[model samples]
Target: MLDGSDLKSVRKNAGISQTDMANKLNCDRRTIINYEQGVCEPKSSQLFRWLDVC
Candidate 1:
């Protein structure tokens, strides 16, 4: 599973905002916030999409 902090770090390093990531991943901005905040986890497909975005 992808670690939330690592996910946040990757997103930050990629210079994309949560909204940008959400748009790329076809998810809600709050989902990105939840993932980054460790409030929830993303599915494997979402992880792949995130990898593609980054």
Candidate 2:
């Protein structure tokens, strides 16, 4: 599973807000925020999309 640093780095490099990334990936901002905070991990499909984005 990706760690919080990976999530934060990818999102920052992608130049998008949590909300924008969530919209593109069809999830909630809280989900993305949780990911970046290491509060929770993404689901399989969400992980795939995150891979695509990063």
Candidate 3:
């Protein structure tokens, strides 16, 4: 599973913002914030999409 810090790193390295990531994942910006803050984890499908995006 991707940790919050790892997700943040990947997102930063990919040169995307939380809004952009949320758009790519078809989710809310708050969802991206939650994931990056370690408040929640992504579902399998979401994870797949996130991996594809990053």
Of the candidates shown, which would achieve the greatest lDDT relative to the real structure? 1
- Listed in order, each prediction's TM-score against the native is 0.91, 0.82, 0.89
Could you say which candidate leads in TM-score? 1
* Candidates arranged by lDDT, highest first: 1, 3, 2
State which candidate, 1 or 3, has the greater TM-score.
1
Q: What local distance difference test score does each model get? A: 0.91, 0.85, 0.89
Q: Write the per-residue lDDT of candidate 3 for residues 1-54, one digit (tens) a residue.
A: 669888889889989999999999988999999998899999889888887898
List of clashing residue pairs for candidate 2: none
* Predicted candidate 2 versus true structure: per-residue lDDT over 1-54, tens digit per residue: 679888788878978888889898988888888988999888778888887876
Cα deviation of 2 in candidate 2 (Å)? 2.4
Tell me which residue pairs clash in candidate 3.
none
What are the RMSD figures for all models against the true structure? 1.0, 1.3, 1.1
Better of 1 and 3 by lDDT: 1
Q: What tens digits encode model 1's per-residue C-alpha lDDT throughout 11-54?
A: 89999999999999988999999999889999989988898889
Q: Please give the lDDT score for candidate 3.
A: 0.89
